[model samples]
Target: MAQSVHFSTPVDTVVSRMRALDTALPERDGLAVFNRVYLTVTEEFDRQLDAGLFPDRRAAISLDVRFAERYLTVAEDGRAPACWRPLLQFRRHPGVRPLQFALSGINAHIGHDLALALVDTCRTLGCEPADLEDEFDRVGDLLVSLEERVREELMPGPDLFQIADPLTHLLGSWSLERAREATWAAARALWALRGLPDLAEEFADRLDSAVGLAGRMLLTPLPI
Candidate 1:
């Protein structure tokens, strides 16, 4: 089940909560690894918002906050899709590389949470996913940019890229571009399923499990 959040100011609330998590969680914790990446993105988005990059700031903020809330909700309620389960469950495992932790969170959030967030934003705005396409594209671009940083900051040294390197192969398998496209399609499908809650839940569950499986593989507790 999703946790209920009461935000007097949606954007500020989400950003502050993420910052708080950043301060509270250990630097090496899996969730903390992802939190750092997400916090950077959120700060950038807030800067962009202040600069008037979004045409409908209110709508964009609503979407952004709602999207973030999905991830945070999982942290609070522990009732998350299978996709996020691995990250939460392995947060304290010293064997998982920070890169793996970061990517696993990205997979869970983009692969599953983003689709649901789209539906949530649509409901709040009385609009459709198409109506928020610009915001989605903008946010996706930000996330993609962050992935490059993730690679640079977390990828092992050049000496470790041998043919037998499991980390290299694991990181190579996932692509932010492909994830974004799939997420968009999933969002559309989920929106279409809104009228059938049971079917929608089933679809969401499958997505969760599939992404979770990928995350599990990524967090294979390599010899790094």
Candidate 2:
């Protein structure tokens, strides 16, 4: 019989692990911090999924919870509070569409992969093919919904240029510091997703490639 999955570790244990992970992240680079945060958050989400925390085998709720905890921790950490605030603000702001779109894409990718993994695991455990088909259909519906949400977020609006302009200006002011941070965050998110099974591994690989391109863009010299 397949063993029932459960979260054996206490909540405190997960929190401690997250704290340790945060402390180990690079402190001098804002881009590094962004990458680290996204990576860490995704890992926590996967941990929750592996532990069977969600009814639907999706990572959205877990991501929200992990993100909240991370934000609280950064706000309380005196030495890094200033640096974290802007990032947190960006997350909360609706005008920063690209960041939101990127996060939504990450979430959708992970959620879809997890659902597929769960279906495969269930089949291995002797689930009937019909039931497995049903589950797959459900997961497919969810993925469609997630994709639609991502599309809506990514769609350019009248303020699209306006929103991107400020970020571009900020990057120019800091010589791509913020852009570098965004790249780092993308890398970390991909790293965290790497822990999933084969499907997730593929998704992570794609994300890794995307991050690499983004990172190169960040490092490109801006015309003076």
Candidate 3:
């Protein structure tokens, strides 16, 4: 028999663990780490939904909303978590495709929030929003291209290994190698605005530490 797990506990534990790890990071880099962790958690939640681990799509989205709420609540108080409440309610509606769309919207919301946070962090170091926006756009383009490849080649056929190959070889490699690319860009933008030499380094260190912690959590076995 398969064992069932409560939705909130493991997710909360992971967030709490992440919080401890966040302490070692610089503030700017910490935000990037938080963004990565949020993305990873949301992606895993979606994967569970696809695998039928939840009773239905509704259940999956409900669980996701709960997880997101817990995550945001822990990270920045209850403010941002309130935004995800609508997503939870949307799950109760009928229709698989609409539910999927809503989930996509939720992901977009989270992404935008991260991007804006990056901009704000840069601004605090005296960087211009336009410069940060440019970097964000560049990163978004790269992500879109990678996503297209994953959708076209990896998801369409029975040869799962082939799809996994590129995702593993290309996207995975890029993510690992350039994990701090966003922080670098943010730092550079800040430098351009204020000539802050230490700002970028500080942010980069924090991001690296956070990512390391998140990687460990991902590898850890959950009770589920």
TM-score of each: 0.91, 0.28, 0.30
Q: Across residues 1-224, which tens digit of lDDT does each residue of candidate 2 receive?
A: 99856553333454565566558644433323344434454455556456665564423333333333433444345222222333333343334444332433233223222333433444345443343343334333443454345445544566656555544553333222233334334434444454565855675456445433433333332222
Q: Count backbone overlaps in model 1.
A: 0
Q: Which stretches of candidate 3 lie over 4 Å from their true place?
A: 1-71, 74-83, 92-94, 97-103, 110-115, 146-224
Q: What is the C-alpha lDDT of each candidate?
A: 0.87, 0.41, 0.40
For model 3, the run of ten residues with the poorest summed lDDT? 215-224
The candidate scoring highest on lDDT is 1
lDDT leaderboard ranking: 1, 2, 3
Candidate with top TM-score is 1
Residue-level lDDT tens digits of model 1 in 115-141? 889889999889999999999999999
Q: Give the clashing pairs for model 3.
A: 25-206
Question: Which parts of model 1 have CA positions greater than 4 angstroms off?
Answer: 1-9, 161-164
Instruction: Write the residue-wise lDDT of candidate 3 on 123-208 in tens digits.
Output: 45454545444434433444455444433532324654653444333323224224334544544454454555487545544543
